[model samples]
Target: MRLRFLAFLLLASGFGLSSASQEDSPRIGDPYFHSSGAWGQDFRDQWAFDAIGLSDPYVVWDALGESPSPVIVAVIDTGIDWNHLDLSWGSLWTNDNEIIGNGIDDDGNGYVDDRIGWDFLAGTNQPWDYDGHGTFTSGLIAAEVNNGIGMTGLNPYARIMVLKAVNNFGRTRTAYVTDAIRYAVDNGARVINLSLGGPSALELETAALDYAAQNDVLVVVAAGNEGQDLADYAFVNHPAVITVAAIGRNGERSTYSNWGPQVSIAAPGEDILSLRARATDTLMNITDAYKPGSAIVGPDKRYYRATGTSFAAPFVTGGASLLWSRNPSLTANQVRQALLQSAKDIGASGVDQFTGHGALDIGAAFAADPNASIVAEISSVHVVQSTDGPAAEIIGTATSDRLEIYRVEIGQGETPSSWKPVAQGRSSVTNAALATVSASEFAGASVWTIRLIVNRTGGTSQVTLYRLSLG
Candidate 1:
C-alpha cells in the first residue's frame, strides 16, 4: 500500500535565515501575529494547547516539580529537522547503544551508526526532513518550552525519536513503516505517532501495530484526510491503534477529517502554527498557500501553518508522553483509558462518530487515576441517533462488581453546576441503553452536559461527565 502524509498545506512564513552551520545563527521566536500584539498581547496562534486544557500545564508540572522524566515519542514521517532552533538537544532522543561514524553496527540492531534515529528511505543515520512534514509533527510533540522560543509543545518532557519512514514527496511504502514501528519499539519508544495513512491495509503494517501493543507501546494514528466515514478503513480500526481525527479551532470536526467508530479522539488541526523545516518548500508552491496574507518571510522563518489530522495526532502523542512521564507504570491501555475518560467530550451526546470519546485533554489525563479500572467506572457512553425524531438514545457500559445504581443526568452549559436526572436508579448492565435525550428538551441551548453517576453498593460513588451539543 502507498501511504501519504495526511495534511492540507495552507501557509509557510519565515524571515530567510541562514543554515544551522552558521556562526551567528538566527534567533526564532513566536509568530508575528502572536508576539507583535496583532492578535493580542497575550494571545498566540497555538490555540490547540488551550483547547485541550493545556493553557497552564502547571497543574501537571507543579505536582511533578522541576524535571519530569522524558518519554520517547517516535515520529514516523518524512523525517525531521533535528537542528531546528526551537528543538534543543535535550528534546530529541539519543541512542546510547549505537556508536556513531565507526562504520560498524555496534549495537547489532541491524543498522550501522544509528545514533540519533534511522532514515529508512536512504538507509542512513541522517533523518532530515526534506519534505517538512515530520519536522512540523515533531514540534507539536517535543519543541522546547518556555525559553521565550517559537512554540510550546504539549509535553515538555517528550524526547522525540525521529524515524524517517516517508520520502520527500510525502509518500512511504508498507515495508518502511512496518520496519520503523519495530525499530521504534526496540529502540525504547513509549509512544509512536503515525501522521500518515493510506487506502489499503497491508499485512506487515497490521502486524506492526500488534507488535507495538505487545511491547506496551502506544500507537496514535491520524484518521486520514479524506473526510469520509472510515468504517471500511482496516488500518485505523485496528484494535491496538488510537486513531485521531482533526477538529478546527471552533471545536467542530474539520471538513477534511475522516470519521468513523474507530476515531479514538479529536484535536485542533486548522491553521495550526508549528516549526518549519529549513530548505523545505512544503507549502510554498501550493495554490492558496497565502490565503489570508501575502507570503512574507520575516523575524521567524521557522514557523509553518497548516491543517489536517496529521497535525492533530501529535497533540495526543504528546499527551500520552505527559501521562507516562507523570507515572511510568501506566500500561498503554491504561493510558488510553485515561485519555478517553479525561477527554473534554464534544459533539453528539457521548462517544460519537465525529469526536470519539472527545477532544484531547492533557491536563485531565495527567490528573486521571491510573488505576481507574479497579473502581466503579463508566467505560464509555455514546449517543444512538434515533431514526424517528431529534431525540437520541444514550447507550454505554457502567459496570463494577460493587455496583448498586447508575444515574444519567443532563444539564445546560459546557460545565454545568446543576444537573437534573434523565435516567436514575438503574441496575448495572454490560451493554444497555441508559436514557433518551430530546433536542427540544433543552430549547435554545446548543451545549449541554451528560453526567454519569455510578453509585457503588457502599457509599462510594464515581462521577463521569460527557458534553452534549445540538443545533
Candidate 2:
C-alpha cells in the first residue's frame, strides 16, 4: 500500500503545523497501490523533496542498492538522535576505531569511547540530540531508505557523522566549532554540514575552514535566517564553503532565510518533514510551538515539520556526498563545482546574490564526466627517521585518466609558491589508483608543506601539484 507524505510547516518558534493530524497529511493522487518495488522506497516524498530537480534518481531502482563506498557526511550541529526509530539504522556513521562504553580513548584521537560520532557540546562520545535541530538535519541528509518507513533522505546510504558543536540552549563557542571541524576532517569525513550560522567573523573559524579545504573536505554551510545580505559573513564568503539559502515550495527565497552573493545555492527549506525525538523537545513540546494534534508520534520518535536555512544546507551536503560516492575519482572541488554548475537557475535569470547559482539539481549531476581525471585525495604524509636512514612516505589516490603519480614535494616557508618535489614515484590501482613514495624521499625535517603532482591526459598533462600541509 502507498502512504501519503506527512510534511509540516512552522507555525511558531517551535515544532508546529496547523491543526493537521497524521490522517490529514496531504497526497496528490489516489491511495497508492503496491508496485513490485524494493523496500523503504517513497516515490511521493521524492517529488516533494526535489525542490532542485524534477527527476528522482531513487526511482531508478538500482540507485537504491548500497554503494561500494558510502561517503560520511559530518553533521556538525546540535547533535543527532540516531537511536530514533526512523534514523537508528543503516549507514549512520560510527567511529570504527572507537569502542563503546569502555571509558577509554581506544582510537587515541583524544575523545574517549566515541563509538558513534563525538559530541563536542558536552565533550562526550554519545552525540544524542539534546535539541531536535540536528536530528531534523540528519534525516534530510540520510535517514536510511528502502527499509520501508518514513521519508527517504537525499542520499539513502551515505553515512552521517554526528558532531554536536552547538549546545542545548542553542549556543556555540568558536573553539568548540573549530575543534569539531578538525575532528570531522581527521576522522575520514568526506563532507561536513554546518546548519548553524551567526554574524561573527571569527579568525579561528575561518582558519579551521581553510584547514578543511587544504585537507580536501567539502563543507556545506547554512546562511543565517535574518533575511539580509551575507557578503561580509565569514563562513559564507570563504571560497572553500558552499553556503546555502532556503527556498520554499513556490521556488522563492524564504522570508526568514538570509540571502546575497555569498549564498552558493538554494534548496527546499520550508515546512520540511523530518524525524524528531520527544526527549529533545521536552520544553517545546508543552508550548504552542509543539503541534501535538499534528505530531506523527509513536514510541519515543515523532516527525517534525519546520523551516529555516538550517534545513536547506543538508540538501546540498547530501547531494555532494551522493555524487562523490558514486564516482570516487572526483576531487572535492570538482564535486562541489560540478554540483553548483548543474543547478537550475531561479529568480532573476543567471546567478544572483539571493540564490547564487540557483536551486540544487541532483539528477543532473549524474551526467558529470566520470573520466574527467580527478585526483581525489592525499590520505597521509609521514616521515620516519631511523638509525638506517630518514624517509618520508606520501600516500594518495586518483581517477581514470591519471597517467601516473610522480613527485612528492616538501617545503618549509611563509610563501606557498616556494616549494619543490623531494622524490618522484609511480602509481598503481589499489581501490582507486594509488601513488606511493617513501624512504629517502625526505627533503627536509621541518617540512611544513606537502605537494603531490599528478599527471593526467598523457604527457600533454600539465603538472598540477596537489598541495597540502603536514602541519
Candidate 3:
C-alpha cells in the first residue's frame, strides 16, 4: 500500500527532468491568466487549484510539447460541448479511421459516423452536450490554453474523446455506461473518466469496468455522494472501482462527499470552474457565478464554478492523460501507481477516509512518475567527529543499473509531522556516488530524509522520493 506523505512546503521550483546530459526542458506557449502553481504563491480563491498542484502544470506542458493524438482520454459523462472556445479541436479526438457524415460504421466498431466520439444515450453521431456537467468536467481535464480564450486544465494539449453516457437530465442506465466504456477501450483511449456512479452495482457495468482494467485502460470513477462511510470510500457503488472523493477549496472533505478506505485520492471539487455549455441546461442548476470571481468571462465563452465528486474525478483523469502524453508506453497500473505515490496526505495522518491519499498534486505526480530509475537510502546516520565537537552529516549511496547523473536532496524537520528542504545539489555523478549532507543543517533537524534522484533532461518526470533515507 502507498502511504501518504505530509504536505511539504512549496518545493524547489524550476525542477526539470534532467538526463546525464542535463538539457533544457521542452518549450510551449505562455500560461493561462491565473497564478501559476510554480513558486508556492497561493491563488487563494481556488484553494483546490493549488491544493491539487495545478499551480504548475504549465511546467509539464512547456517541457512536453503536444500530446500524441492516439493518447485520447474518454470522458464518460453527459456529452461535452466540443465547440466551446476553450476547447480546441486540435486536442479533440477524431476517429480518422471512420468517415464522418456517412451513415455507416465505417471503422466497423459498431457505431456510425463517430467522427470525434459517440453518444451512447442518444445513439447519434453528434455527442454534443445539452447539459453542463460533461462540459464542466471536460474543461477541467483539457481546456485549451495560451490560445487565450479561457483557463487551462492539467495538460492544455491533451486529446479528449467525448462519450455521452449520462443524459442532460442527469439520468443514466447501466447499459449506457457499459457501452461507453467498451467504446472508449475499443478506440485509442488510454484513460477513461466515469464522473457518474449509482448506489448499487450492476453485473454488466462491473464486467465492463473489469474489461477496461483487463485491457490496460485506467478507469477513474467517483465515490458516491451519500456522505457516509461505505468501506474504502465514504460510500461506493462499485466496491472495487478506482474511486475518488471530493474536497473543498480549503482542502477539507466536502460535506456531501463520500469517504473511506476505498478512495484513491482527491482534487478541488467545490465550485471548480470549467467550460460552460452553449445551452442553458445544467446539472446543479447554477446558471451564473454564485459569488464574485467564481466564473471567468471569456472572449467567446464562459467557465462556471461547479461542485461534486464528479468534478473531482476528472483531476485524476486529466493527470493520467498527461502522464501518457509524457510517455505512452506506461501501463495502466503504472499510471495509477504514480498518481497514488505522488498524492499529498491531508486531514488525518496517512490514508484517511476524507481525503484518501490526499489532494492530487500533479507537479509531484509528474516528478514521481515512471521516468526515474535511481534508488537511494541513508547508508548510515552518524554524528560527524568535528574538530571542535560532534556534528551531524548523513552518508548515503545510490545504485542504478541505468547510467545517469544523480543529485542529492537533504531535508530537515523538527518532528515527523513537518520537513523543510535544507540542502540541494551541486554534485551530479553517474551510477554510483555518496550523498553529501551538511553537518550543521543535519544537526539542527530532529528528523530528515535523503533523496538521490536522476538529473535527466527529458520532457517528463516522476514525482517520488526515489530511495529515501529517513534520519
Candidate 4:
C-alpha cells in the first residue's frame, strides 16, 4: 500500500504549469529559414533544427523497419480538431466496443458511448475544438508527416488521444480535470500531456496524476507562462509531472516563459504557430508581440494564437510519445530520466531554476540506447558476511534470448570455482520482468566471492546482480 501510495505521488507530482500576463514586444525573425525561403516553408533547415539535430522526432522514418508503432499519447486540454488534415490520422482512441449513438456504456469505464474521446468541459461526448487551442497542441505532438500538406509533427506516427479538460473559454474546474486524468489512465494512455493549469492546487488532481504514474502512464506538463519561480507556488510544484519551460529559436529562454527549479526541460515555444481552422491555410506566429486579439483563419475556419507556456508542453509530450513508441518497455521514470539526461544544458551548469536540465535534445533522446543497463558490471566480487543463507543471486544471461542465474563456490583469498546453474528463464529480449535469485543456500559461509558467468547464445545480453542479505 505504501509503495502504491509512493507510486501515485510520483505520478501526480509529474503533471507539470503557471500563468502570466502577455506583454507587447518586437517579433523575433525566423531563425530556421534562409533568405530564399520563408521559415514556414523550410523550417526544418533552421538552426533550431540543427541545434537539436532532429527531423520530426515522431516520424522515425529510419526506424520504421525495425520498431513497432509507438504508444498512444493522451492530450488533456482544449478539444482537438478531428477534421484537420495534419491531425486527422492522429485523433483520439476510439472505443470500438461501444456503438456511436445508441446510448450505451458498452466499455463501462463510466462515460457513455464515447466512440471518440470525452469532453470534461461540456460533460458529454462532444469534444470538438471550438477555440482551436487543443487542435494546435495536438498538431505539435502527432500531426501526420510527409503528407505533402501542412507542417510535420514531433511524433507524426504516434497516436493522439484527446481528453477535453479545458472548455472553449480555456477554463477547467479541478474536479473535471481529475476525472479526465483518471479516464485517460484507465483507458490506456501511456503518455498524458497537460497544457492547461490553474493557480489553485487540488489534492484530487494530485491523486489522479499519482494514479496515472502507478499505472505506468507518463505525464508531461508546461511550466507556467508566468516568469516567476515555481518554488513559490504549490500549484506547479508537484514532483510527479515533468515540468517543461519554453525556449526560443536563439536557444535562449523565452522572455514570456516561466522559470523555476522544478522545470525539467525546455522546448521551442515562442513564435510557434500550428494548424488552426480558418478560411485559408494561414499560420499565426505567436511571439512576445502576440496580442490578445491577433488571429488567423485556416481551412478549418477557426482563429487563434495566444501564446503561453500552455503551447510549449505539447512538444515535450510529443517527443516522449516518439521515444516511447520506439521503446514500449520504457517506464515513465526512465522516460523522464532520459529526457533530462539527454537535454542540452542551458542557463547554468547542472540544474537550475531557469531551465531545469536544459533545452530538450530530441535527436539525443531518440538516438539513445533504451535497453542500456542501469547497473554496473561486476569486476571483482566480495562477500563480506555470508552467514547462513542461499548462495548470492548470480545475475547473468545465457544470451540475449535467455536470462540465467547461477550458484558458484567462492573460496576466501582464492579464485571462484566454476559456475553452477541455479535458475534460468526466457524473458523478452528487452526484459520486461527482471530475474531474481535468493540468498538462502550460503547460510553460514563467512567469506565468498560472487561471480557472474555469461554464455553468449543468440546475442550479447547485459546482466545485473544484487546482493541479498538474510538475517
Candidate 5:
C-alpha cells in the first residue's frame, strides 16, 4: 500500500501537481458505504492520542492561563473555508478600515481591500476555500477544539490567517506563493504554513523566505510527498524553515514522505482523516482514511480521502503557533530549535535522513520548563593552554551596590566534584564586573570548564555571571 502511494506521488509530481490535488478537484471516488459507529476505531481510542503524544512543552499552557488566543498563523495554501465550523473560533481578522466593496487601498499594504487576506491568484481579498485544500490544512493547525463536532486542531485557539496562493484548479505559480509569503510576514503572521511544493526552485521564493527569517516569522513547509531525498531539490533546501516529513502509526517514515538531511522532523500524516467537504455541501468525517480502501462518497456526491505529508505540515505549524503565542519573546529560530530538540528520536541515536530529529513530542514539550535556568554563577576560573588555542572568558556583574564576592573554579566535567579552583574575583559595587584570565592560560587539548560562585557582602546584594565566551 505504501509503495503504491509513493508511486502515485511520483507520478503526480511529474505532472506538476505540488502535493495532492485540491480536495474539490475531480478524482477517483469510493463506493458508498455506511459505518455503524463513529468513523473509525482510531477516533475513539485515547491510546491513539497517547501514541501521538502531542502536548505543548515549555509549560506555556499553565503560565498563559489559556491557550494562546488571537495568534495569527497564515496558511499560505489554496484557501480556507471561512464558514467551516471547526475554523470559526479563530478566523482571520478583517480590515474594517477598508470597505469590502470599495476599490481603495484602505490599509495601504500593497493589496487593495484585503479585509481578510490577500488572494495572489485572484488579486483580491475574497480568499474563500473553493478547493477545500486550505480548509483541511487550516483545520489541522487551528481548527476549533472541543467544539463537540469534527476534529481538534493542534492550536485551536490560534487565528487562521488565510493567504490563498493556489487556485481552485490546483494550479500555483512561484510568484504567487512568494507574494503570499511576503504578505503573511507583513500582516503580523507569526507562523506561515506551506503545504504546496514543486520540483523546481525559485529565487523569489528564497528571497521571500530570507525576508521572513529576518522578520522573525517561523515558516513550516512540507518535506514533499515524493518519497525522495529533498537534498536533490533546491526548493526545499531553506535552512531557516522547518521542513516536516510524514510518519505512520508504526513510528516509521510515511512511504510517500520525502527523506533527506533537509527533512527537519516528522508528524503523523498516514491514514489520518481531517475535515473534508461532502458532496451534499456539508462536512464529512473520514478519519483513518488512507488510499485504496479509504475513499468516501461525500454528500456532494464526490469521493474524498485525506492523505499525504501536506496534511502533516499544518500540525507542526499549529504547534509552533501555540508555542510562539505563549512565549511572544521567543525568536523564530529559537522556536524551531525547541521543536526540533523536543522531537522523540526514532530512527537513530541522532538525526537521520528519514525522520530528522524524529516525530514531534508536543506533550513532552509542554511538560518541560522552557525557561528553567541551566546555568549558575560562582567565580571565574583559568587554565593553561597553548597561545594559538581557543580562549575562555567569564564575566561577572554585581546586582547591588553593596559588596558582592564570588568563588570561581575550573572543572573537567559538568559536575562540581570534577572542578578545581584556578582563579577568584570579588566585586564591591553594584556596577562591578570581572573577566577570566587570558586565553594563553588555557590552550592545547585540555577541556576545561569554568564556574562562578557569587556572594553578598552588604545589604541584599546579588551577583550574576554575565558573559562566557570560548573561541
Candidate 6:
C-alpha cells in the first residue's frame, strides 16, 4: 500500500499537481502531525529560529509593548501564496489609494487595481505564488507567530508587500526587478528583500537601487550560491544594498554560500523549514537526486526544507522590519548599522570576508541604539609609577544620549589598525580615570595610540583618540 501511494504521488508531481490535498493539511487539532516522528525529527526543523536568537520572542514582544506600528517589507521574487494557512491577511500591505478589482488604475501609478501589489510577470494584481520562492521567503519574513499551527516568524508586526517579478522557473531579467523596486519604494515599503540575482550588473538595476536608497528604503540581497568569491559582483556590492551570506545549523558558513568583502552579515539558510506553496514542487524537484523523501517536511505536505542564500536574506529583511517596528524612527542607514553592529561575531574577530560582521542576532538588534551619539574628548594622559612597573593613567570626559558603558584601549604606534582593551567603566566620567594602561604590554613601543569608546545599549559606539608618548 505504501509503495502504491508513493507511485501515485510521483505521478501527481509529474503532472504539476500537489501530492496531498490542501484542505486535509496539518492543523492545530492534529496533535501528532507537527510533533510526529515522521515529520519533525524533534527540534531539527525550525533550528534556524534558535540560531538567530529568536527561540523566545516574548521578551521582545514585551519590550515592544501592546501594538507597534506595522512596517511594510517588499518581497520581490516569485509571487507569494497570500492565502496560505500560516500567513495572515491582516499582515499584508494594502494600497488605500487603489480600489480592489475595479479594473481601473485608480491611483494613477500605471498598474491597474494594484490593491495589494503588482505582478510584473503576469501583468496582473493577483500576484499569487506559482514557483514557491516568494512564498517561502514571505513566510520567513512575516508568517504569523504563536498561531499554534506552524513555525513563528521573526517579526509579527510586519506587513508584507508582495511584488512578483520572477517567473515560474525562478528566472528573471534585470528590467522586471528594477520596475518592482520602483513600485515597492513608491508604495511605502520600508524594506525590500531581493532573493534572486544573476551575474550581470545592469545599469537599470543600479538606478533602481539608487532610487530606493534616495527614497530611504532598505534593500537586502542574497550572495549567490556559486560558492565562488563574489568580490567583483557589482550588483551585490552596491552601496545601497545589504548583501547577506548563508550559515548552517552549526553556525558556520554553508558549504555552497558565496563569500566576499561585500557580505554585510550571515543568517540561517540550511535545512530551513518554511511554507510550501500550493501546487509547487520546486524543492522536491531540485533535491530528488541527493536527498530524497526530505523535501516535503510534514505529512500534510504544507512545509518544505531547502537551503540557499536566498533563504538567509529574508531573516535580515525580517530583522529590519522588526527593528523599524520597535523604533519606528531609524533611518535606512541606521537600521543597517544596528543590524551589522549588533551581529554575533563569528569566523573572525571584528569583521572578515566570509561572514562580514557576523551571524544575525535579532535579540541584540532589538536592544541596539543606532541613533545614540557621544560627545567626548580625552583630557590628558600621564605616566604613573606603580609597583607593577610603568602604568599610564588616562583621563577623559564622555557622555551620550543613552550611555551604558565606556572602554579604553591601547595599541602600538601612533596609528594602529587594532587596539587592545585596557580598562572599562560603566558610568559617564568627567576627566576621571577612563583607563589605566600598563607600559609593560607595549615594552618596545615609544609612542602609543589610546582610544576611548562610549558604548550605548545597542552595539553602536563612538570613539575618541589620543596619542601618548611613552618615552
Candidate No. with top TM-score: 1
lDDT rank, highest first? 1, 6, 2, 3, 5, 4
Give candidates' CA RMSD values in order: 7.6, 14.8, 13.3, 13.5, 12.4, 11.3
Candidate achieving the largest lDDT: 1
Estimate candidate 6's alpha-carbon lDDT, on a 0 to 1 scale. 0.74
Error of 1 at 74 (Å): 0.3
- Model 5: residues >4 Å from true position, as ranges? 1-49, 55-63, 66-69, 232-234, 278-305, 367-471
On the 0 to 100 scale, the lDDT of residue 43 in model 1 is 31
Superposed model 2: Cα runs more than 4 Å off: 1-47, 59-67, 282-301, 370-471
Give Cα-based local distance difference scores for all models: 0.74, 0.63, 0.62, 0.56, 0.58, 0.74
lDDT tens readout by residue for model 2, 1-471: 111111124533322212212321143121111111111222222333546662334442244346546788898877777677667567687887877888989888988987768888577877877667788788887776545555556675588888888777566766777788999999989999987766555577779999999999999988877777675554666766898888877788887777664677888877566777546542242245554434333222466556677778888998888776677667788888677766787874444557766788877666655345433334344565646565554555433355655554555542345666565545533333233334544335434545445555555222222333343
Which ten-residue region of model 2 has the weakest summed lDDT? 30-39
Clashes (N, CA, C under 3 Å) per candidate:
4, 5, 23, 34, 26, 1
Model 4 Cα displacement at 33 (Å)? 10
Candidate 4: C-alpha lDDT: 0.56
> For residues 245-362, could you state the per-residue lDDT of candidate 5 as single tens digits?
8876678887778876567788877544445532211112112222332333223322223557776787788777777767777778767766776778786433556777678876
lDDT of 4 by residue, 1-471 (tens): 000000000000111011111221112122212121222222222223334545333334456447566577888777777877656653456767878898888888788978778898677887877666778777777666556444555664667777887765556677776777788888888888777654645566568878987898888877766677565432355555788888766787877666654677788775565667423222222234333333442233332233456666777787787677677878887787667657787754434456666788877877655543221122122233334433343332232223333222233222334433444444322212122334554445554433333333434333223232334
When sorted by TM-score, best at the front, the candidate numbers are: 1, 6, 2, 3, 4, 5
Over the stretch 56-141, how does candidate 3's per-residue lDDT look in tens digits?
Answer: 55576655655443368898877888778778888788899988877888888988999989898779878888877788788887
Question: lDDT tens digits, residues 1-471, model 1?
Answer: 787888775423432332221111123333321232222222346667668886555566666656667799999998888788888889989989887899999999999999889999999999999888899999888778676766666677888898999999888887888899999999999999999887656577679888998999999999988889785563585666889998876788887889765787899887676778887756543335344332223355676767788899998998888888878878998998788767777875556567777888887887776656412223334445565466656665676556778888888998677878777755665546667776566676789877777765656455555555675
RMSD of 1: 7.6
Query: How well does candidate 5 match the true structure, expressed as C-alpha RMSD?
Result: 12.4
